[model samples]
Every structure is written in structure tokens, then in C-alpha cells.
Target: MASRLFKRPWTRSNDGSEATTASRPETPDDDDFHDAEEAVLHPDAHEEGGLAFNNRELLESQRSAIYELIRDMGMKFLTGHINLINMSLPVKMFEPRSYLEKLTDVWVYPALLTKAASCTDPVERMRWTVTWFVAGLQHVFQSWRKPFNPLLGETYQASQPDGSTVQMEQISHHPPISAFQITGPGYLFVGHSQPEVTFRANAIKTTAKGMRMLHFADGTSIDIVYPAYYMRGILSGTPRGEMVGTARFTDATHGLVCDVTFGKADGAAPSDRLLNRSDTCTATLCQLDRTNLASAQANSSASADASQERGWSKRLGGLTGRLTSLSLINRADNGLPEGSQVIGRGLGNWLSYFEWDHHRYWSIGESHATLWQPDPAALPSDCRFREDLVALRAGDVKQSQVLKEQLEVRQRQDAKLRKP
Candidate 1:
């Protein structure tokens, strides 16, 4: 049978940017968006009291199957935390792409990094880096479906329209680590992530753990730390994906550090949810003194949000000399001395553009360039060659499940043999 549901079509504006909801004209895609409500629980699908994640609302039979599997797992699931590193998920729960490809989503707007690299001012460069970081996060919560995990030794290679090249390798299996390096004009971004996922009651949390470094040709480098992700209401209510916690961007070369706090998902307002602004974030940049360094490194999501609630005004007056909103940044006179003063602040949602010092940096709707597309000349061991993924893409559910199981069994046996 043909698929029953079709969400929005990928539409673009005349400027090549993804069309914003504000400017998009009525089209068949609107009907698709409505049809999607039956399969996916989006913001508009909420009931009177709150939103819910009903298995009946899902696309295929696999959602109910997975729900049953989890329910049967029951008390076993109650055990402290269930790690998904070794888990073989149902193929239907995955998008037909591999985790390696997902990593490249960070470079959707290659221009952001190029702008950062070309900047002469270290603080301005840091601002651009933070903007790039914020802009790239829009993809993480686009849907609840997970990307297929990369098999050990798997590799993916692609390039950008801007002449940048990207390469990713599934370097390890037991702990499941993937490494990638992207080379662009005047900058090199290399990082390895071992994503850790834990299952909690009615929710799952994931953290991308590892080292990420961006080196510019001018010898200026940035050290990045990513935030935590949460997919809530998996069992019954509305299935929602949110990004929480704080991400740090530090430029040691200039003694400047930026702390970006992704606020909790705002479910109270339907309007905010519809526009992808339900999850908002704010960023503050300050000089890296020993005291400031200690404080920045010690921030958790709770503490970070608590600090903001306690009053950024007081903090801006003293040691942490930076405003927390774009409006305040705009009011600051540009003639002020550089050091020991508030440079600029940023405020925006994680799923769209943000304003820095009252200037809008990048918009998710405005990014129309295709930076990375799958290269046809992939190696034999590439994720594109995975039998299960191939089967799924071909719409052979049973064969996909069987192939997935076989692959998982082989992986387990190989891992056991490698153990001391």
C-alpha cells in the first residue's frame, strides 16, 4: 500500500531560502501538514488540556509495535537507566539516513562559518561562531524519528557548493563513536561524538559527548561543548522533542567565552509552538577571567536558568559584564572602550534565527543553499551500503527488520570475540 501521510513539501523562496511560515502562500503542502497531524503529533494537534503522543496517531504499524515492546519491557525499563548504545531499534523508527549524514547538518549554512573566519575582531568572530552554533541546532528537533546508527568502519563523504569538503567515519562500535572533519575556506572543523542516550520514564535524553574544535587560518581556535537533548511523552501523551542545558563556546586566544543557554520547551502558548519558537535561548559573552572561567564551566541547565532569573542586570553591572538581551546590546554606545565592558548579547529561539546586539544574524528561513549532498561515489563500507537501510528505503519492512536483526547479531558476536 502507498504511504497514507504526507507532511509539508520542501519549499523555497525566490531568494533560495526556505520559505518562512509568514510568507509561504497557500499550497498543497498545507494539506500535507494537516494530514501529518494523523501521523505525527505536532503543536497544532494538541487537545484541550495538553498535547499527547498517541500510538494511533503514528504513521505505520511500527509505532504501536515499539510501544508494545517498551510496555512489555516494563519493570526491566525501571532499572536505573536504559542505555541505547547496544540497543537495536526498530528500523521504522529511523529516518532512512545514517547518523554520519546527520552530523553534516551542522554545515547547512557554510556562510556562517565563513563569515566568522573572515572577521578581524575577535569578539565579533566569537559572536558569529555562536550564531553559527545556534543556526545549526534547528535540525535536531525537526521530528521525533531517529537517524540510523552508523556501522563500525562505515564512512560517508560529501562536499559543499562553496567548495568545502566533509568526511565522517564510524570509528568505534562498542561505545559507538563517530568522527568527522569538515574543511572550508580559511577554517577547519574537526570533531568526534559518542552520543549517550538514556531511557527514563516516558522520556529519553541524549547527549553528544566529545571534543569539537574549529581552527581558523589565522591561528584563532574555538572549543565547543554541545547541549543535551530530550524527547518527552514517548509512551502516552504528546511526543515532543526539546533541547535543554547550556552550550559553551570559548576562544582561549582572546580570553572570551560565550555561554548559550537553551531554555526548556515552552508548551503554554500554541502560537509559539507553531512558529518553532517554543524553545527559546539566550547567550552572554564575557571576558575569560579565572573567576568567570570557573563560573562558566560550572553551569548546569538549572543553575544557568536560575542565574538568569536572579537578574542579569546585577551581573551585567559587575564581573559578568554582559547584557542578556538584544535590546540592551543595541543601547550600548559603540564608542565604549573594549575591555571590561558589556560587548553584546543574543536572544532568540533555537529553531530559528537569533539577534546579536540588536542585529539579526541568520534565519532558518533565509538559508537556501545546499551545503552537503550525498556523493554517488561512496565506498563499499559506507552507510549507504547497509542492507537494512536499503531494504527500508525500498519499502520492504519485513526484510528490513530481518536484515537489521542479522546485522545486530553479527555486531554482538564480533564484539564478544574482541573482548578479552
Candidate 2:
């Protein structure tokens, strides 16, 4: 009767920040971390997960009717193990953001990381690199809907607001791989990602492979790998997502490995309404402090165990950035007009790993904005300029489905004609 998933919470309005108060406790020592947090989270069920979409105590009281309709239509059968390229789903389920735009969000990194390639200190380099990677993640998991499948050979490009530009090419059709390149004044990036999926009765897992590669003018280089993700709350529960797996940034040139594992989920009890943080991992990373991280990384055996297990927290619903603490919160609108909404750092369902405090560490914000602009005159193969693309991105489900199928059919017909 209730929904069950997020993988991401709407932390705030897209416009601004929220005000802070003395609601949070003074920082706790490593041993007192869990006990401290337990005292802080609201005890009321309705006040849970910190709402951002609405001012009400609970996040938009979801209706069981949607699930009923989906069941009446046998939606589950079509949901599993199908090639998304050929499958069709309602567009209302997806975020309007495209994967290309998603890429640009993270590409804001090169600017933050240009100095990464030039720094001699491994820790400093890893620090900057990790920040770049994490910044792009704020909005990645906000919805359960999938992006419109870029037709085979469909491409996309962006000329950022900053002086940078990025290009992406959908290289394969069957397995669906996308390759991209970004060039700017001080940096260059080249990477490709291929997705492998596993569909479970109650969840869908999407694994993105081939870490990004970035180069600085000084010949410094590194490769980045994304954390694996899962769409949960399928069928009978709320739909949401969780960023699992260890994201890695390996600087072969600098002999450094920065691995960040999103921590475990924490609900009030063993059988709480929440159904997130997979069942595979054992350690609860929600409360890891810098001392604990340093202790873990300094101990050769613990570091090895971390690498071998590659598994961090399975609860707490926050992330443990290898050597840092990160606290995330979004602004909540107290039923105010959009213009009247007060902004601050705390509201919504915040995800913090305690590794990032504005005064503590990893706090250089806004260093990753891009300079280029979106180019309107994209080539025929570009996804942005594809016919009907605007409608697809605008969430017009029926129109997008028709266009998707038409393009696929056209490609097949042309292939048949090419057969000699």
C-alpha cells in the first residue's frame, strides 16, 4: 500500500539554499557517532527522510492507485530483462534531464580538477579528484524513470556556459555504449560507458562501466569509475534508487587510488518501511569519521580488507568518501511561493558522510562550472538535434514512443538494403 525507493531525495528546490539551525548535535567522536545521530533524527514517521518536494511532513502522500493500474496492465512482465533500447515505458516516469546533460553536470569537474594533474601531493590530488566526481552526483538519482534511449549513432554535444565543450557519440546499438570527449582551456577528457543490467522482481540494477579518463595540460592523467546503481521500490513499494559499489579514481601517474563507498542505510528498526541499501554489504558506513577512515586506511590489513571486500556500509543511506566526511541536505519550502522560499544548507533528505564540512575539508564549491554554451546547430547524428527530441525530453510519452520506434525501424530498413 506504500511506496519504497529513492536512491535519491529531493534535497531542495533547484533555485537556492536553506537556513541552518542548532538542530544538529556537536560533532561526535568516532565511538559516539551512531549514538549521536540516533538522538538527532526525528522520531515521527511522517517527519522522515526530510521532504523537499512539499512542505507537508511526509513527501507527497503517494497513492496506491498507480500501483493498481500498473498491475491491471501486467506492467511487471515488460519491465524485466528487456533491452531498454527497444522497450518503451511511460515518459512521466523519467526526469526531464538527458544523460548528455547529466554528463555536463559532472564535466564541471575538469575545472575543479585541472590542478589535480599538476599537484605533486597524492592526497591533494585525490582530494580534488574526488570532489569533482561527487559534485556531479547531486541530481543523478532523483527519479526512477530512464532517459530516452539515444538512437544508434545518435550523438549529443554541449557548449557549456563556461569556455568548455563536450561531444558524445552513441557508438553501439545492441549493448548500447556511449562515448564522449570534452576539451577546454586547461583540460581534456575522453571516456565511454556501456551499461549492463539485471532486472529483479522488485528492482532493476544498472551498472555503468569504463571510468572516465581526464588529462591536464601538464600531462597528468587519471581514470574515474562510477558507483553502480539500482532502482528499487518496484511493484508493491515506493520507487527509489541507491548509489552502490565503490567509485574509484586511479591516478597511475601519481600512484594514487581514491575509492569512495556510499555507506549503508539506516531505518528506525529492523523492519522499517524503508527497503534500500542492498543485502550484500556488511559494514555500516553511515558514521565513519576521518579518524576511523585514517585508521582504516593506515592499517594495511584493513585497507586490504576494504579493497577486497570493496564493500562499505549497507545502511545509513549516506556515502563514505574514503578519507572525508560529507553531509548533504536540501532546502525545504515551508509552503512558500517559489520566490519566498528561504534557502539554507539543511533541509530535505540530507545524505552526509561526515567527510565534507565547509570549514573542515573538501569545501571549494563552484570551482567546477563550465564555460561553453549549448550549440544549436548540431549534426544529424547528435541526440539533441534529433527530430522530436524536444518532445521526448519534455516528457511526451506517446510522441516519444512513436518517434523512437520510427527511428529504429528506419535503421533496420536501411540495414536490410545494405545487405548485398
Candidate whose lDDT is highest: 1
lDDT tens digits, residue span 73-173, model 1: 86767555888756777777777778888777756878989999999999989988988888776556544567788888888988888888887888678
Q: How displaced is residue 195 in candidate 1, in Å?
A: 0.7
The sequence of per-residue lDDT tens digits that candidate 2 reaches over residues 184-228 is: 666677766677666556656777654366677766665666776
Off by over 4 Å in 2: 1-86, 90-98, 109-111, 115-120, 264-359, 363-373, 393-397, 415-420
| lDDT score of residue 209 within candidate 2 | 59
lDDT of 1: 0.65
- State in Å the error of residue 413, model 1: 3.0
lDDT of 1 at 264: 36
How many residue pairs clash in all the candidates, one count each?
A: 4, 49
Model 2 error, position 210 (Å): 2.2
> How accurate locally is residue 123 in candidate 2, as Cα lDDT from 0 to 100?
55
Local accuracy by lDDT, each model: 0.65, 0.46
Tell me each candidate's TM-score: 0.71, 0.58
